[model samples]
Structure formats: structure tokens, C-alpha cells
Target: MTAPQSPIGAHVPVAGGLATGGLKYAAEIGAEAIQVFVANPRGWALPEGKPAEDAKLLARTDVPVYVHAPYLVNFGSPSEETLAKSIATVRHSLVRGRAIGARGVVVHTGSAVSQSYDAAMAQIHDHVLPLLEEIPDDGPDLLLEPMAGQGKMLCAKVQDLGPFFERLEHHPKLGVCFDTCHAFAAGHDLAAPGGVKDAMDALVATVGEGRLKLVHANDSKDVCGSAKDRHENIGAGRIGEQPFADLFRHPAVAGVPFIIETPGRAPEPHAKDITTLKSLRAD
Candidate 1:
């Protein structure tokens, strides 16, 4: 049988329940897949997972679901308490992910904050290894998303993830979520000749193709090497529309889902952006 088309979707809100709010949002936006926050993104409070509601969402096998770990999670935090909390939160996120049958859980590579990169990597090694060790057989893949080359952030660029993969012994459960805006912000110029392809090649070299799990399909508000994380709409941003064609055509991401994390949460704008992305795929 032929593989289904690569899904193009957006970050959807999970206000009511994963089935009701997030599922409805995906349908409204014409998304074939979606990403949602399992708990409060800005806070440390871990809420109960609604498996009954999630069952309803999962019954619709046409839509693949991905979970975005809370933004406050920093596995490399200088504070021991914060590092512990980050580990606990990631563990909880994976539990919820398993309950909901999510494809993967996305977490930021995060910052070291007043610590050297070596020190930060050590902290991450200490915290994340147990996570890799204890992932339930049915748990969702843990995906690491590199940042916009911000201060002391681990995995600030694609190349920075090599040591991390090595530390994990290239665990099968570990994966990656590449964000276009972050790539541009970190100095990978999709607009330059041979740039997007070169970047994808480098990513494959660093993380291997199987671990490339998802794409946060976004446009950047800032120019290349700015190290800012501002996201723009599909065709309106500095990255523009043409470069996305290159991204869609790249072999590294051949079957990966592209989930828009652009500015608007409303369905109309997201639908338009998804349409733009689908059109680019055929170009």
C-alpha cells in the first residue's frame, strides 16, 4: 500500500479536552495532524490526563497527535530543584502521551543559565538518562527541539546535538523536531543557494534520518543569526515562501509531518498557512 501523504497541521489549543478542544481545532483548520500541550505550558502544575476524552480523539485514526512539553521545562537548569522538576515534568508528559497514544512529545533543548556548556551537558546527562531508561514500552518518542541559538542553550544548532545523541547511545526512543524559524534564527539560511539542502544534510548527519520525527513549520520575524525566537506567518515573514518549497522537497523530511506554530491560534489563518504549505509540497 502507498504511504499516506505527509501531514501538514498546526499547534492547536487544548482548552476543554484533547478530544473536544484540540480535535475540533484540528478539524476546523483542515489539519491532518496536530500538536497540543498536555498540561499548563507556563506553569509547573501537572493536571490529570483525561484518557476517556483522549480515547475519543484517538478513535479518529486519520489525525496523528503530538504533545508539546511545557515551555518552563529546562533540563539543564542551574538550580537542582528546577532540574528535578524538569525531569518529573518530562516523565509525566510521557505518561500522558502514552495515555493519549501520541506519536511524540516535543521538549526544548533548554539553557544552562550561568553554567558552562560542559556543566549543562552534565546536568542533562544526569537527568535525562533515567528518562531514557524508564520510558514505558508504549511511551511516545521523546523529541528534542533545538532553540534559536539563544544564550547557553544546549543544541543551539543542529550540529550541537551530536554529543547528545552519542550520550544517549542513539536510543531508538529519542527523536527530533526541527523548527524552520529556529533554524534561520540560528544562522542556517534557507534563502541562500544550496542552504536548505545543506542544512538538512547536516541534520541527517548529526541525528540520523529515523530520529527526525516532526517539523515545527514556522517563519521567522527576525533575520538570520539574530538568535531571536519570534515566529511569523507562512508567506509574510523574512524566510518568505519559496524556501519552504526546498524544505518540502528535502529527502531528510520526506514523510515528516509539518505542524505550524505561527502567531495566530484562530483556525482561518492556520488553514491558509496549511494550504500554502500543501501547495509548496507539490511545487
Candidate 2:
């Protein structure tokens, strides 16, 4: 589903506990869906969820959930230790995701630091393909969210996804988690006329249909093509608001859920964003 046409939610806090805090925050924001960190977002440690909390969240079928793998996960890393840790961390996310009945798990498509892009891509192929193969029929899809066109980053522009699918051989379970600010920062120029449509069309053409499973509804603090990942509140950034309205009208994401990763403490700002997305809907 598209923005207004689909579920609009946010990345809720899991501090109080998965169900205790995440679900409570989701309720406070009027979210129809949510994304969360199964473990620490910045670390490599994989912690098991509380069984009762897992059961509690798993029972709430109304609010669909998603898991974001830790930031340290980078399949393209040249370090063997980092590579192994990345795979294990992602696999952990997949297992945790299924335990909580999550629809998908989002992982950042990472960089090729200090090496050739081809070599880095090879590393991804060597590692990620097998990981993709491990997904059970009932398990969640692995959603790759391309980064801002920052330093050695792979898969920034929509066009960059072509090789990703080709390398994975278009695995049945692989999907995309498109991020608005990231795209804008990657030079998609989404604020211009027909820009959103152009980028979406490019996405479908690059990966084929139905691969876009999620949207990170964010605005950028930096100018277009700046390659900065800073996220601003909706309508308060350089990308403006029209592109998002156009995003809701795009057919490629017709039923995909949109989740905000914007700046906020909780509740109030996220609630306002959910309202903004609802208003952007074609009523």
C-alpha cells in the first residue's frame, strides 16, 4: 500500500520491553504498523526477546511489525570477522522477526569501504545469497534499504538495485524498504515535478513489481544529493510535502506500509506525522 492508502506508523521505542513499551508507544501514536530493533541498533550483540513479551506482541495481529538489523551489519565489509558477525546478526533478526510474527526485516545495504565496488558486491553475493536461501516459506522477507549516496556506499540510487537483484538472482523472499530522505539524498530529486513518480517507476523497472515491501517516510535535513542521512520531520525539510502526496498516488507501492523514522522523542511528533500522511491520502 502507498502512504495514505496503506498503514502509516513509526519506529516505536522498545525500552520498557518489546510489547510493554513498543505496543504502548504504537497505541499512543495511532500507528497501524510499527518497526523496531530486536536488539541494540548500534551494536552486534544479539539478545533473546522476553517470551511473555514476544507472545504478547505476536498476538496483536492488527499492528503489523518489522525488525531493523543492527547498524553494524555490513555484508560488504572486507573484515572476515565483521562479515561473519553481519550474517549471524541478520539471521538472528530473521529468527526474532518470525518469533514475533513480523512481516519483514530491514537491513541497510552497506558500503564498499577502501575496496572496489565489484569486490564488495562479490562479498555480498557470497554471503547474502545463502542467507536469502535460508528464509522459510512462512518467514519474513529480507528488505534492503539502500543508503544515501555517501562514501563507498553500495545501492544508493534506484538504478543501483539492478545488480543487487541480479546478484541474488532475484530471490523470492528479497524485498526493498525505500527511504524517502535517503533517496532524496542520493540524488533522486524527488521534490521536483513528477520526481516521485519517476523514482518509483525506476524502482519497479529495476527490480520488477512487488519488491517494495516497506517505506521509511522521512524528510531530509540536507539538500538533494547531499548524501547526508539526517532525517527531518515531514514537510519541514528541503523535499517539501508534494512529493509525498505524489508518493501516495504511485502504483508501485499501492499497498505497502509507510513508517516514519523522523526526529522526535515520541507520541506527539509521530502522531502529527501519521496525521500528515492521512491528510496526504487521496480522499
31-99: candidate 1 lDDT, tens digit per residue? 989898888999898999687678666886678889999999998789988888888888888888888
Instruction: Show where candidate 1 strays beyond 4 Å.
Output: 1-4
TM-scores of all candidate predictions against the true structure: 0.96, 0.96
Q: Which residue window of length 10 is worst by lDDT in model 1?
A: 1-10
Candidate 2 lDDT, tens digit per residue, 172-202?
9999999999999999999999899999999
* Residue-pair clashes per candidate: 0, 4
Per-residue lDDT value at 82 in model 2 = 90
